[model samples]
Target: MERLTGRLVQMYGNIVSFLRKCIFYILSVGLIPNHIAFIMDGNRRYTKRLNLMQGAGHKVGYSALMSMLKYCYELGVRYVTIYAFSIDNFKRSPEEVQSLMDLMLDKIEELLREESIVNRYGIRVYFSGNLKLLNEPVRLAAERVMLATAKNSKAVLSICVAYTSTNEIVHAVRESCEEKWDEITLLNSSGGYVPDESDHLIKVTDIEKHMYMAFAPDPDIIIRTSGETRLSNFLLWQSANCYLYSPSVLWPEIGFRQFLWAILNFQRIRFYFDRKRKQL
Candidate 1:
């Protein structure tokens, strides 16, 4: 009887899984986000709520992120970017900050060694941030994962660690300026350069090419978990016209239903967004 009961449970689980796959396939037939950016928030709050250890919340958040990536890839979304660690996160208590860094290092190393989501989906991994801010061990682990997944092109996963949009913009500006210095000097050498302005003024395209997220097109949808409606400096410039969705659930608690709701909402307004895209 026990064996029969086990078999029944397995059968029920399989049926549920099959039903979920069907629903996902049906949803994929509609307009889907080609690229999605996730701002994983409320980790500390989640931990506090559960009264867990200092870093357990982040571990749970990592699991949630991996599940979302699988669902996105299965739904044919080709690009995924996650705001893993923000630059302002350094302001947290030293022990908390160090715990997060250690957690990141472990996750990156696991992605390299384990047959995890990246490997299963042929996703190329990228770490986009000021790596210098990370300790040497963590930096090296990040680099190793990047190199390990460099050639896999089935999909792209960008993890923003120690990053903020403000810093990204500044980096782009500095890089763009440095690259154009020679051209500027040549123009000034003509000796009649206008002091007010010139036709060679810095163009928007110049800065865009130097942006960290330039490797992928602008995200079609940006999802921030947690009730906070603000962007928290995740992807400012790249998100000028992107659809923003904020769900009140914490990062670790976000599930398929929430993701499905986000995609369906995106579909409902996709026509309006398309019109806006053309206008822009």
Candidate 2:
């Protein structure tokens, strides 16, 4: 009897795996986004719904995040970014803020342990934002994971912590100014070239290069959960023409089916977009 039950369980697992592969293959035939950004919202609300202790929502949301990352990678998505936390979030009550910080630190350290998702998928991890705003312990842990996974090229995971779209733009502008200054100084000293009006002007590309997310292409699709239709200050500069998907489910409640629907929606309009681009 025991042997029969074990065999049945194995067979059931095999069936589920086969179905997952089929889903990927079907989606692959259509447009597959190279990068996807997620606004992982409704964590606290989810916790409230479940009647769990405060901060438990974040833990559940973390599990959903890992599962979604794996799904995206299997579907040939090369880049995934999540709105992990915003600078505005610091205005919350002290206990809630501390809980979030502690949760982030714990998750970062967890990524470095054995059998971590980062190692499993060879995902390179990056944290974008003013990381100096983070406490020392959290910042150090983030750096450790980033350095540890730097060589993993299979996929990229960008977590926006201590971040907001306005803050990102400001940071980029500051860096671009410094870069332009260095160029001007080099031209005047080494090349004996005098500055002109054009030399002082900064191009759009200048600021783009200095942006923290310069390494990855802009997200092709941005998803928000919990029925939130607004961008909520995410990827403002990068998402000008990106497709947006907002589902009614909470982040922790989102499953593979929600992902499937988002991809199908993207596929539906990709052809129209491509033709329009050609005309342009």
TM-score of each candidate?
A: 0.92, 0.92
What lDDT does candidate 1 reach at residue 227?
76
RMSD of 2: 2.2
Off by more than 4 A, model 1: 1-13, 186-196
List per-prediction Cα lDDT, in the order shown: 0.89, 0.91
Tens digit per residue, CA lDDT, model 1, 1-280? 9999999999998897788789888987798799999999888899999999989989999999988998899888999999998999999999989888888888888898667888999999989888889999999998999899999999999999889999999999999988887767877897745546456666899999988888988888999989777889988998877889899999999999989888999998889888988997
RMSD in angstroms between candidate 1 and the native structure over all alpha carbons: 2.3
Off by over 4 Å in 2: 1-10, 189-200, 275-280
TM-score of candidate 1 relative to the true fold = 0.92
